[model samples]
Target: MFWRLLSTICSLTSCLNAVRVPGYDYFDDSYYYELKNLLEAPESLHGARGDHPREVNGWGPGLELGQVSGVSVDLEGRPVIFHRGPNVWNFKSFNATHHYQGEDGPIAEDPVLILNPDNGKVVRSWGGGRFLLPHGITVDHHGNTWLTDVALHQVFKFPAEAKAPDLTLGEAKVPGSDDTHLCKPTSVAVAKDGDFFVADGYCNSRILRFAPDGKLKEKFGHFGGEWSDSGLYVPHGVALDEARDTLCVADRENRRVVCIRAGLHHHTFGTPVRTLHPASRARVFDVAIHNGVLVGVSGTAEEGNAGGFTADLSSGEMLGEWGPLQGFRNPHAIAISGDGSALYVAEIGPNRIWKFTVGKTFLPTKM
Candidate 1:
């Protein structure tokens, strides 16, 4: 009742705190949106499945990282993974309040693992008792690690060599749509300038942008309607292409990967600039961008189309499709090397990590 009265008495700008983004005078107009060739996705998309990417066998041996939620590479080109350790997210994991119903509290094993890229040896492992139901991760250009937890409904930032998170957003165990709260925030993408974007996928169905100091800057997105230009359903992953000023989102439930403007200006802030669809049945899970490539991985066991595709990040042209030579059970998260030579994918059901050499030479399947 108090909020309702205040909203009625105040203008829209006065009701909520606003942070102005400085750009050219041309970009300052909120009434005009400049959408180029962007279009809404069709009801059902069909395309040819490209080639198979030979998966390297015996990559990360003896590493018991369970249900790898996200993967990224650090400055030294080492693979870093955020996982659930021993905890599994099941149907009964969360109650009606989106709170953990488990009696185990938090998993005992370390949730973050840094590995040697060449032989896949666990070099550094930490982040124990710091998260619940880990969901997403991004290792930035500055070597800062970003992570998200659906159970806690929060996002955290662990500085390059820091033991604890120097920055964290969202209330622990609390969920709300206001600027102070995030509900089931799945992924985060940090730009070179320290600005970042978060996909509040589950509860709010919105994409939020924040400044380095953790202030809400701008946001746009909606829920429902499969073809809605700004609609987001289960956005599981986000990737920022620093060079092209493009930010691609793995719109999981929608079965497509969409790109939007990531810099000082946007055509339509929420509208997709280019939409790339995989095999119609595949549910896009995670995406990685590098060079001129955009790789999207999907895992839909029920659809029987669990695989991935490589596309032109700028033109949305289908370049290739990838999967394990032994087939993927339930691939979850994907990460690309800084040089765009190596691709890493993690699976949940079989609890496996795969390393794919982008172009060719690799150790063949050992019989």
Candidate 2:
């Protein structure tokens, strides 16, 4: 009788613990509750078949890294994504047991670029010697690739065919320091006349402008939390609005996207025309403006953090969010297609890239 009573009490405790809590159901499913089922028994579902398991699509493999930091669609209509890993040399360094032994050992360093939603082919790969920690990538109209390495404190411009960069700017000229020159540059944007802008993000909070000949034309912004024309707090991403002649800056820590109107007086950053502060407290990371809409990726505060959201560009309304999709594990950067038909996200922790077919309303739909 005592054993029977104890078993009943244990069952009741389990039931109580499983009770649904409001706003705590991070993963909500409509049909079959597949995500819930997977959460309950992850090992059993590892190789099982389903409509869409988290990682692959139709035999296309995903990326391999600690986290993916940036993504862009190439001129050939291919999706290229970049990853940031903790260890630069051996994959074993990623394991906690071996992490300390290799603190300074030939740290495995290389940023991976994959052509996804297209059979997982690595069409081109570069930047092991170029970057200590690669964070962002953008292609100019001339078909050249521009990449930012926060650790190396430099921005490299690699021509289409060159294995190494044809032009190296910023910290490449001076080693081992974060100055106004290019301290941890995160994002890059090219103008029509061949000039470019680099968001010297992360440590030194300023935007550095360079002319076509690679000369420092001017620099603006400072490090601050205020919302005035004075400073920027961890500016991570940047974009150029060619038609509006404006510069869109993703002031990440401040939780806002600030617009610098073109033809305005120099060093003047106008008020944000659109703000994307959700009540959930997620912070904005990388942003891209396409088709008159602003698309961005929001990240949680913790490491190995999964589950991000999207918002409307014009109204800042909650569009839709997915994941905790295959244990997302820290989605860092985002890119949208020209027509807004697809949204590509880079999962930095799991070292994978996910391409979601945006629904008619610009949200992810179950495949």
Candidate 3:
């Protein structure tokens, strides 16, 4: 009788499991496989002589530009990558003109949107009028998109449905001069309360804080090399750790990641409790916090080389590093999957995105 009862329970559990989980039939493997093939074949993705290279140099730095700034996954599970080219004048050599033209001279290369890894499809892209040189991008909790334009020196908020961004803040009213409002804002992070943080990278080297209503709350950091300090040298990326109520900043030029308690006085920047430095001279470009681990991408100033690394957010201990996969060329930004099992890297120089998947537990180990 007990054996029979166990058998019945097992059968019922199996039925429940099947009902709870959806099958993979909707995700046709053939479609994804074919997409991968297209991405691997440069000719299919790139435009004509003036065409963009689908896998690399599709947006033109002549396949040699290195400036991937931000990467994220959309609500539909598609990957979004952002980059800023040197300047629009440089694009003339390639016979590529700005999507938006002006007599005052063309703005820098606007953000180019691309589908997730191994799929070189150019999804919907719009940002030329709304940006000078878009350096970073993030989706807020409300599904709104936020972007930082370093050359424009401003942070812009765009409604999810906006075909062209309507400036929610930092237009002609930025605190500093019209052109000096933001000192090279690079990365953005939205807090639970809708407040956002901007890493004023490159020029100013500070973190600008703003409320949901677009008022500047406070700003932190300066230019320096001190430890656990507020001063920064070319801060590039920013992330908020809601669980710990801390703000993590990627001090790119300093070659370390810094953390500070949220809502602290700007001048009282706390000491960094953790630091991540790779053995080589590669500068850390961007970082994302996932499951208490900080994953970052690193590369040299020159082209043709870049890699990724992971470290413990709590202890600052280096976990592991891997790279040169899927033709990764100067990986600048990284975004992890919701389940933390997959990672998407943006290759700026190649103008491509690469996906890396962790082996599942049920998979057999290789000999």
Clashing pairs in 3: 45-54, 46-53, 46-54, 47-51, 48-51, 53-58, 56-350, 228-272
CA error at residue 347 for candidate 3, angstroms = 2.6
RMSD of 1: 21.9
Write candidate 3's Cα lDDT for 192-301 as tens digits. 68778888776678887777877777778778984647768888888776665667887887877778766643424344555568544477788876656666777753
CA displacement after TM-score superposition, residue 111 of candidate 2 (Å): 3.1
In candidate 3 the C-alpha lDDT for residue 340 amounts to 55
Q: List per-candidate RMSD values in Å.
A: 21.9, 10.4, 14.0
Total clashes, candidate 1?
0
> Global lDDT for candidate 1?
0.75
Which model, 1 or 2, shows the larger lDDT?
1
lDDT of 1 by residue, 194-278 (tens): 9999989677878888899899988867775458767778777888876777778888888878787775454445545788787
lDDT measured at residue 140 in model 2 versus the true structure, 0 to 100: 71
lDDT of each: 0.75, 0.60, 0.60
Best by lDDT: 1
- TM-score quality measure for candidate 1: 0.81
Candidate 1 residue 174 Cα shift, in angstroms, is 0.4
